[model samples]
Target: MTDSASLPQDTQSATRPALPVRLKAGCKINLYLRITGVRENGYHELDTLFYPLSEPSDTLDIEEGAAGSGLTLVCERADLCTERNTLHKAWRVFAETTGFRPDLRLTLTKGVPDGAGLGGGSADAAAFLNFLNASAGKVALNDEELNEVAARIGADVPFFLKNVPARATGIGEILVPCEVDLSGFTLLLACPPEHVSTPWAFKAWDDRYANKMDIDATERLTLSAHMFTRPSSRALWLFNSFESVVFAAFPKLRAYKGSLIRHGAAAVVMSGSGASLFALYREMEKAMQASESLMREGVKTFIHHL
Candidate 1:
């Protein structure tokens, strides 16, 4: 066993090339998400396909610490630190699990918009944890262990660790890697400045479905086998259980999706529970044109080909 604390001063001081690990964490769009049922433990059982998109993302950098006891974090956004920071929580859990006595300095460069349903924070945390685990030469935690810790931090963290499109179940932890090809398609993401509480979205869903249609049936068909056959199939299959709940509260988000359709998007849908909406275009030129138009309209937008 390699003891992180007992190494000789000379050995530790012989700088190992700075080891400044930088990782690009991808964002996701919930192509289809269904709230199957509520669990006894209060977590909702869900079925969803987490589609990785070539859009906005956050970058993380980690370097060996000079002399410290706990991890230190600096962020591009000043308000992002403190006890509520997801990266901080990930660092704490990793430190406790590996006993590596890490003196790490982490820097987060935020490009993803806050509360846009793009899983920005989750990506940052997962990337940071992975970088730290690799840097320390510790046994890599399997998917199960990684997800267990991820769920403790946030619902979206585990999905980022997978870093690919997957059909996720059980509060979004169960992953079935999909072989969907999005090579030529470009994604246009537009997010208006706003925030939506996940808990509140769930609560609104319960109220809306109290006497409504069957949610399971509506959601199940969208995730059926036919969805993987073609890119255009996504136009019919795009469904998010939180959309109704979110749209009822924030009508502008719904309008944004409509605008994407009018702007030549093949398919448009809300990314997660609330504000960010995305349009998938068959061509990169069209996507870029739409993104530029949205930016001029004062919406925060990103365009990328996946």
Candidate 2:
């Protein structure tokens, strides 16, 4: 649960870390996610809250390359080595916008799972963007300008730039700081083998709730924020809009959530679209108890004490 601020600010100092810079790109959990509407362009508008997690992160080792060497990305994971990967997009976009393309080589080690609805890829891209901007010196883009460039990478990329709890709206590019304290709670996350597609989740939701799409968007947005302000209503806010559609398609995921509750979780909900579930407990003992229970069933789990 380290704050994003804990990341290297040494990049700002005249004495920067030597040639090879190492950065940890963490993932995120969507505490509350609701689809408010779908734009004509087919992008879904969301009212969601993002909370960063340090575990299940990807590591990036970067070093300056010879001039005219361009950017070279190497990853053991074949899928991520492609030019279409978000990291490549981030580098290209940042360079086009800032004209500060440094010849560099990046090596990525993935600890996060793809399509787990954990925003792992987005986090990696944002981390790279921050590093590039810091290295750009006088050509560095300001926060607002950087966010605009990040949006081009992905909807969730901008959030990782600051990596704090935030309420995101309008296709997830817009962000505002939102603090929801969980000082005495423990978070236990269970990642099942299932990988849910974001596009499929949104389309399923649309087909199922098409008639309800025209409902008052403003009312829902106001309530989403207000729910966090009241501690007693926190349980009610643990809901995710994608669950109804996602669970119906993956029965095993539904059963896993039930198992978590039966094991003493105060509250449990699937993170983001699907494939991962996180539970909250008032005590770490209870969280550990739940973690062991799920692990015995052969499910991968992570425990974070807040």
Candidate 3:
């Protein structure tokens, strides 16, 4: 986990007059990721499609308190429940811009593991913001305003607001609906025992593409709506810009991908700058067998139906 100690201190409260509003924040995998260029604002311009999954989601129970009571967060992972927390950061932005009621608390139940490139933290924040918009009419912000709030928190925050299949650009905030129908497909996600920091991933990306952005002819692959509409097409288009560099660092993860493919996976790609790898299969039995094989290799695995 590239030592979070250096990352800038990057959540919620509870109280009266309402039942706790529980919300589920879905996790996602990038079907394709492309770094088109770097923007002058210091954010990498991206072209990626997000595919949300139902199984691995974090749950949040939010409750509002008296005004000026401030925000409080309760979680098993206190390190992730602080001001640097995306939920806390999103709350700060939303409350400041929208004049939201200050006192709030959130009990966060984390199901999605962090640093897996699943956008778990961003999704948790987005889910809470959705709850605030629907329940707190006094602090109601329109979709446009809400989008801005999400962008302020993280690049992936805005995308998780819609929480469906989307083609995202502009540092991953700009979104357009994309067709990614993975119905009946089985996904086997294997996490090697490690984490890759986002900063490290980006620096690696830049270093790899600095002088020769098209180092790999495959890096310039174009995405189309029709490519994600069916399983066959989706398999053909599966790409992640981080895979080459990341796999070089973690050969076990790379080997896992190859193993899954050999075990009949139609598509296997690193989800992000990942320590986690996901493989899609047409049959659950094949996925199950692959999981057993991976487990024998000491890589943790989970099978999910798409």
TM-score for each model? 0.82, 0.90, 0.84
The backbone clash count of each candidate, in order, is 0, 0, 7
User: Which ranges of candidate 1 are over 4 A from the true structure?
Assistant: 1-18, 138-143, 210-234, 283-285
Distance from true location, Cα of 181 in model 1, Å: 2.2
Clashing pairs in 2: none
After superposition, which runs of candidate 2 have C-alpha atoms over 4 Å from their true positions?
1-17, 215-234
lDDT of each: 0.71, 0.82, 0.74
Best by lDDT: 2
2 or 3, which is superior by TM-score? 2
Angstrom error at residue 175, model 1: 1.1
lDDT of 2 by residue, 1-306 (tens): 122322453344454445677889889998878777777788888888999998878888888877897788989988788899999999999999989888989899998887688999999999989888877777778788989999999999999999999999899999998897988889998988888998888889879865555557776556445532333213877678788789899998888888888877788888888788888988888888888888888888989988
TM-score ranking of the models? 2, 3, 1
In candidate 1, position 252 carries an lDDT of 76
| Local distance difference test, candidate 1 | 0.71
RMSD of each: 6.5, 3.9, 7.6
